[model samples]
Target: MTKTRRIPFVVANWKINKLQSEIAEFLDNVNSKVPSQTVVETGIAAQDLFLADMVRATQDSPIHIVAENVHWEDAGAYTGETSPRALKDIGATYVLIGHFERRKFFNENDSTVNLKVMAALRNGLRPIIDVDEDMSKYAQFMDAEPSVAQVASALAGVSVDQIRNITIAYEPTWAIGSGEAATSEQAQKAAHLIRQTLAKLYSPVIAEQVRILYGGSVTPDNASALLQQPDIDGVLVGTAALDPVKFLELINIAKQPSMPGQFDTDEV
Candidate 1:
């Protein structure tokens, strides 16, 4: 990776937490802590109610605003649903599509994930397509990680340019919020598989350009170890992301130099 290469990306997935006021406070705290010497890109994936609040708070800050979820269609009679256009209009430049919770609780599948991905791109919002493993299939994952089929499906028919602008988060279902996170090596294997799938889907150039993030029990303590991995470009923090101070600590950790000579690596 060169100086002009893809910069490290960090996202805070607030899920169902935070009041509008609290979101403002968190962003204020975070914006203050981001050192002037570093270059880590940051974003907050808050719920629908707080998207505007987050966007307004970070308007002048370097932090990008992201929505936690989105509806596939731009408009219709889908009550209580959020449209990609609405999110973009609200100043959110990114949306989290097909997260594990949506998959498990709301019954989201690859097909819908694809729909949301295209919708986000068309509406000018970058899609953070999440690929997670099902815990029941844990041991089988000893050989298979976030399945190539899963990633390929989410990106089905996506073009190279759009692919380059996108982000993929590999959050193994078993490790998320369970206090038992995947080891850096385990996360690397999964990220490698994702990048491999991307290369095959389009081309090596775009594949390497796409950022693959790890999202599973990420904390300030373990963030540096994970960020230093060759394939891992960033993280999608969950519980820990709720705290502005701790989350900023993780961002600072990401800014620390990747282990000496560790990232002098390329696609396998």
Candidate 2:
């Protein structure tokens, strides 16, 4: 592509799906079939209950494990919440926060997401913060504009080098689970806005270093074109990730060399 320093990442968010038994089988499939030294980095974000088992299964492989969500505190009486320390202890390299389901069903807000991100960083875990472009669904219960702006602001001020350890997922709520994918142009436009927002809040250097991903109904068939977009560093795949062959195919596509006119013509 543009010869960027950051590697391409493919994250599978198996939200509330996959049993422990299934996870073990999936790990085996991944270990045996994964590419040796491709440009793409593979990762899976499983349910909180399966984090330990998943990590143990993928310990020997280069595949990274991620927790679907975690609490802001290290340890306490948070009944249904996962501790960041526990996640790190289990060898989780990444944590996904502010997912669409969490924001829609669990009443999670920007402040809570910010705290969780800070806690994940403090525990030496990378945070993959998810931002949904379609906030119309939450407009009545929450303000779309300021809510998004608050999250952007939170990430901007959290750490000394926040963007370095953070990966952003721009999931347009309208496209999620609808079997419809955003056009390459649409995805690049939104992703560029996210980068611009970061640049405005932080410095241009940090914004350039930060990786922005496109999520929602990403499949093997569409991944190549999507990753070819200049602003799209990677993908946060959902249903397509459930199948081993499909998931690997997506990663393989991302690892392919960029073709002419695939990325931005303006970029060197």
User: Could you give the C-alpha RMSD of every candidate to the true structure, in order shown?
Assistant: 3.4, 4.9
Q: Name model 1 segments beyond 4 Å from true.
A: 1-4, 35-38, 134-147, 259-268
- Residue 41, model 1: Cα distance from true site in angstroms: 0.6
Look at candidate 2 and give me any clashing residue pairs.
Answer: none
- Which candidate leads the pack in lDDT? 1
lDDT of 2: 0.79
Per-residue lDDT of candidate 1, residues 121-187 (tens digit)? 9999999999995433443554433347778899988887688679999999988899878888888
Model 2 agreement with the true structure over 62-168: per-residue lDDT tens digits: 78899999999999999988899999998899999888888899998888988888899999999999988553333453212223464474484575465578989
Model 1 clashing residue pairs (backbone): none
Number of backbone collisions per candidate, in order? 0, 0
